[model samples]
Target chain A: MPDAPDAVEQAVRQVLTSINGDLTPTETMLLGELEALAQEIQRAKREISALSIGDISDSHIPVATDELDAVLAHTAEATNEILDCCEKLENTAPELPEGPAAVVNDAVTRIYEACSFQDITGQRIGKVVTALKAIEARLMRVTDRFGSVSSAPAEPQAPDTRTQGQQLANGPQLPGNASSQAEIDSLLASFD
Target chain B: MDKNTNILIVDDYKTMLRIIRNLLKQLDFNNVDEASDGSEALTKLRAGNFGLVISDWNMVPMTGLDLLKEVRADARLKNLPFIMITAESKTENVVAAKQAGVSNYIVKPFNAETLKEKIEKVMVHA
Candidate 1:
């Protein structure tokens, strides 16, 4: 049986034919694609609306970024405490005999060097936070499509004008691939 | 190099600044000042007599590269020795710093020896 939409399409086609002679193949194909897209959109709306989408974004995702922030703060605090200990040890190391003082100072200096791990870790976590926020933004787009966030204005998407990939930092490289201090020193020397 | 050379260490991270300060102290550089970002460091540089700058690469509002360019552009601070001490150890970043007139570059997790060496190297021609 011909469906109700087919009946309406036939009526519209007849009116267009009477006015403009006949519908073009491209226009007919476009109308068909529009109807199919409308049906797919409705199905997607039902499926997305059925799941508790808000909980994933509002409850779980934001907490992950917050937890990352906490880890950065805690590590920074812990590293500072470690450095403070080194500072105190440094101040007292001069009182010891020369040999032991050398050992103590060396150990303290090594500790101070190791404390920079916190800075690297903090930066890595910051990158993670940025990635998580991007995911949250995509989820918000889905939620908005479902009219769950109808009150908030939709984000304006910039038109893609270029075909080239975005120039951005692809980080956390494996060992031996990234630039080492020696390599960096060599590069700097080339400048002179 | 005189132990009294007034040096500036710039970084947004408080812990890093403290670590660098303590490392400098160990290197016999007792005269040191700190700035959390590049802009503040620029202001301090303009107002004071600073011999060297040890700055981190990453910062908001103004980065170490921005500060370096600004310093190089200014007549008074143009000749001031600048060393970049940063976790940004990329080859391109190093090249950029070199081109921007940075005196020496130190990748992070460095020791007092590295700091002392860079300082001595920069100060020799200062």
Candidate 2:
């Protein structure tokens, strides 16, 4: 009962459907994938929230930089102290016999040369600090794009429960982190 | 090398400046001045009459290479002895320093003898 054009159109549509097959299953599959992706994103956000790798404030970056700088400062100070001793000895070397003065001068010169280690180490640490700064900048950009999902800083750490030997020991630490060498020596002496 | 020739030592690290100054003193070159960076060194170079410039290659705001170029470009400072100190002995760094009119180069962690040798090689005093 349909008109000729309508009939032709319907026949063409039937042929196309037969060739292409039904599309409902494909559409359902796409929607299912979208829903799965949404769930995955939520899970990732939760995982990120649980991670304690510093907050969006990135206080860690500056702290790390300060630690590196402290390394430089401590080494420089020690090296300078050694150099001072060497220089003092060298200054008084001329008052000694010629042979002994020559020997002392040679030793002092070697010490001065070795003191260069501080400069090399400082340069190496400077490079690391520079790299950390660059990484922090990238992190800032990422945080800008997809804000921080992490929780606030953790609570204060619990008191030490380890035995005497198992006590926390990150010796050779930064300026304020651990006790000085003199303190440790005094403590070890008292323990005797 | 004239022991009394006024020398300018440039480094951002105070320790390095002190070390170099001490070494120069051992070499009997006590007439030395210090600058913490290239820009400050430039100001001193323009203001004083320094026979030699011993500078570290790396510094903020202005590098030794930049300072070398500036010195070479200046009519008065051109041909003044310039010794570059680099932490690494990379070939490209040597080539670049050479191209920038550096009179000589010294790699880091050098002994007094080496410093003396380089200073003797580069420094030309009137």
Candidate 3:
């Protein structure tokens, strides 16, 4: 039997396909990951909403409140961690596919829009969470695309013997300087 | 028409400032000063005897429009030629800038030739 979810899924797939051109394979994989994460977040939201919300016994209400709080806290922390990862990915990627970057930029813009909506009515943080999840998904796609492209064999180039300032002037370069190397080491240390 | 005409370039981004300065040097306009924002531009304007002012639109503390208005209001600096370069490409924004007494306007991500043409137009018209 045909279902509404099936139709929605088909539409989403069509949109993704239409917009997927020019993305590196890594970007596609990242985007796929992001989509999965967003689905998980949506399920979490549904589960949280499904809990009892009527004038139940006081003891039950406390338990419900505690459970809701715990869920909310977890979601918030996870979202923040995802955003941080996205930021790091963005910083490391030298160049991103233009189409995917536009999509990610659009997602970031949507996050701001969602935050504004929440601020006006003093609503729950769920709207913000949803927007953040969307942004995370977009960023993951962008990074993944960049990663795939970067990993591919490149056309040969002249050996780079330029100073740090010279390289910076030319544009972004891998960390080779003492200061930049130290920073990368520290960042890796933290990750470990 | 000395090559050493004191020119002030104002923008919020350090990268943009350097790019503009380099472009100006190529154009033989060597006497260039820079400010990171509108207020700093004004401070420099008040301190130095600059012949031309090239400013960006969006900035904190004050905007290029505010600086233009202030410059127009001040009797001493009223005749100092001002050109605005901005990312805003809307006709309304251009009209507003023209109404505010800007000598010229150039949309950002512009090339060296476009910048030179606009500057020349402003100089000729002025």
The candidate scoring highest on lDDT is: 1
Sliding window of 10 residues with minimal summed lDDT for model 2 chain A: A164-173
Name every residue pair that clashes in candidate 3. Answer: A26-A144, A26-A145, A27-A144, A27-A145
Query: In DockQ terms, which candidate is top?
Result: 1
lDDT of 1 by residue, A52-71 (tens): 77887888888998888999
Cα lDDT, model 3, residue A20: 68
lDDT of 2 by residue, A1-192 (tens): 663344544555565567776636765465456556656766665575465435633688888898888888889889889988988998999999999999998898788878877877887787788778877776555444445435556458799864221121111223344343234324323433
Candidate 2 — which residues are off by over 4 angstroms? A1-39, A53-59, A148-192, B124-126
List iRMS for all predictions. Answer: 4.6, 17.9, 20.3
| Ranking of predictions according to lDDT | 1, 2, 3
Cα lDDT tens digits for candidate 3, A1-192: 433344445555666678865566776676666667666755754554454322232354445556655776565455445445544544444366877766664454333223222111211333344444565555445444433525565448789974321222211122231123223223323433
Worst 10 residues of 1 chain B by lDDT: B86-95
Residue A158, model 1: lDDT of 84
What residue pairs clash in candidate 1, if any at all?
none
> Could you estimate the TM-score for every candidate?
0.80, 0.72, 0.42
Across B1-126, the per-residue lDDT of candidate 2 in tens digits comes to 678899999988888888888888888999999998889999999999999999987776677887888999999999899987656354445556666777777777677987897788776432
User: How far is A51's C-alpha from truth in model 3 (Å)?
Assistant: 12
Docking class of 2: incorrect
